[model samples]
Target: MQGSTHGIPIDTDKSSPIIVDLIYRLKIRDVMTSTILSCRPEQTMQDAQKLMKDNSITGVPVMVERRLVGIVSMDDVINALMTGTMGQPIEKHMSRQVIVLEDDMPLSFGISWLDKYRYGRFPVLNAKKELVGIITSRDIIVTLLLEMNKEIERFEEATSHREASTSGFHLEYTTRRFDFEMAGRLSTETKRQLKERDLPPKIIRRVAVAAYELEMNQVVHSAGGTVRVVYDGNQGRVEILAQDTGPGIPDVESALSEGFSTATEWVRSLGFGAGMGLPNTQRVSDAFSIESSPAGTCVKVTIATEERSNP
Candidate 1:
């Protein structure tokens, strides 16, 4: 549970700029934004516009009698006014069915919400009918990207700075071109690395699941891929890069669907391509990102030492 940034020790007592990444680990309760600006459900469209401008935000949660009833955004106000209905009540246009996240949920869950929903922001609430804070898409992106870069730097530091232990084990493998045989080899190397590092049982399982799905994606869909495993100090982490030069998935949205598949009959006979590889990768990896195009696809997955408890 020790957290720091850029080799600088972080103080647990004070709120500082770097405190975000550290406080994020302690628990969501401590880092929530408590001072929220809310509006009434029956407020006028003009009222919402002024509130948004005053707060420099695009939306505000609508609370009736201190209870969150809906969310009113600038868009809702504009839509109301643009139709020559400036005098209309805000409730007519406000989104009553608001999506909320509990204060205890990890920042990782916010990633899934942003990816799955069209809203650019979210309302954070506590168990006792209290608005704790707002967790926006930008916040989630910044936290994850920072954490991912931190991990990459940590890996580079360990590989270049510290000397390998005399009694330790080392195994490296490189993969080129996409083929069925190569998939099995990558999987084997992954299990071998987990065994050698003696990583925590929970982390090992998550890494294995993510690796299996990623390798299969490259073998069945992409042009080529690479897998590497290294032991760094007392903990272990796995990094996998899968790249391919085939006609990339034209529609990432469709590909991420639960039962959508582009695999041919030959590939399907192997019990592969239930259209769950990418989605499952998203579900399993602690940090997952995708950059894809018609020319190729590149996917990166990382496993950290920190354990996540799901509700």
Candidate 2:
């Protein structure tokens, strides 16, 4: 929960630069394979293995009367084969405590679940807890790559009308509650702009991390918010402001505490609210300020284009 990056203390934050690339405004149902190949719990292990081989899939969801019961994978088959239990009922060999994904959940939840559990695939269920589809890490990778390319195309189109050598640029983006699909697009664009300006890598990195964390915090925690970025060539600094009209933080001091979180389980599932946003932003910024009340919250983070040499 406590670590240092290039000697800068990192709290319970787990936001990664690579996360900006993976974050998309997508839901699990958007990418899940709706036509699932599955078996029944009463089926024999040999039968399940044959189904897996016929479909060329490593795993299959086990359903019993439209309810998800378990999942059987190639590893289970191999174990059964070794133990001479191939003819046994699949329910006896399959993993009963299956980690499943819901249809409406964000793609980030799937990404986090796979990364945390190292599962080859997950059985997706609907609101009624019925097996609806299946998704694999490959699906997530392909979808994210496509989304990233689309974002790049959009960024190019948006910037095409602007003067290339403009002294400064100011932009604002709106974020909505649970808007996971569009979470990191603005930050990615900001990073692109910084790269075009040829800012120092350290500065760009700090801005990228700050922008991503702020964007995600708004998307996950706020009712709705506006993220504004102002780059000043004269001052050699980029300023980011996030203002949200959500239920504001009651205790700013406690919210900044490492590992402190009031996020719901659903939010935590998508990998936010480990109590790192404000602290991480402050750590990377040249200046930071925050204000909150029941009506709303506003956070301002400023990073200089010039990197500060390590003392």
Candidate 3:
């Protein structure tokens, strides 16, 4: 899917949509196994391998004085054995350049890194850069599954209170300038409201993405804005309206294209502007329209309440 926040477009990956939602909200500490088994750099390669074998694990973090220094995996062990270096210190053969996750980082960040490196597991570090735990892809999958179950339960509960009429609901939120701290707050609230109304998971996911992208746009590029969500139960649809008083997008066509961005270097550094936001919003919404001028920009997105099957 594609969408633009400001002039930057957003793109969604081809992974499972439900899984993406789950991972995007979860922090590493929420899913990581804190009771980690690690090895010291001074430990013999033989000892590290034995520990891994005994625990049925394939990798272990190498530490020095309680701080992470490197990592040793089964591949390292095999190479050591072949080269007759099993007797050497693990530090000698361990991967010195380690890629670690912070405990508070979102699972989505970890997922991206994992996809890039195809690592079996990652060492998780705390604010002090000390190894605190470890996480594997299996852990992420299991956690997401559990979260999905909770969402299902919430849906059931919400549906139990469903009204006979499809009158639906409406909500409005104000966005602030340079409010990076609360960029996605409006979107999160919108998702909560949709869940309370027992909207389908697919619908909720799309609305959430669009709302978030718009919210980010207001915070990152606009002076301020308002996000409004209007759901029509009778029509089985939800519409999102985002209006901002920022300098309007000069080139709407260019803004919709993938990889097109007008964000400053600082915004790019913070990972906010990659030019995929509006395109992603358009991709997920059943209908999308926008109007822009020097005065302001307004975006409207509509999504169906139910998934449509392929003919």
How many pairs collide in each candidate, listed in order?
Answer: 1, 4, 18
> Which parts of model 3 are misplaced by more than 4 Å?
1-21, 160-311
**Clashing residue pairs in candidate 2 (N, C-alpha, C atoms within 3 angstroms):** 24-181, 25-181, 25-182, 26-181
Worst 10 contiguous positions by lDDT, candidate 3: 1-10
Where model 2 places Cα greater than 4 Å from the true spot, the runs are 1-156, 160-165, 308-311
**Tens-digit per-residue lDDT, 174-197, candidate 2:** 999989888887788788888878
Better of 1 and 2 by lDDT: 2
lDDT of 3 at 241: 98
lDDT for 297 in candidate 3 is 93
Q: If the candidates were sorted by their TM-score against the true structure, best first, what order would they fall in?
A: 2, 3, 1
Alpha carbon lDDT of residue 148, candidate 3? 90
Q: What is the lDDT of candidate 3?
A: 0.84
Our model 3 lands, by Cα RMSD against the true structure, at 16.5
**Tens-digit lDDT track of model 3 for 30-93:** 9999998988998999999999999999999988788888999999999999999999999999
Please name the candidate that would achieve the greatest lDDT relative to the true structure: 3
List the candidates ranked by lDDT, beginning with the highest.
3, 2, 1
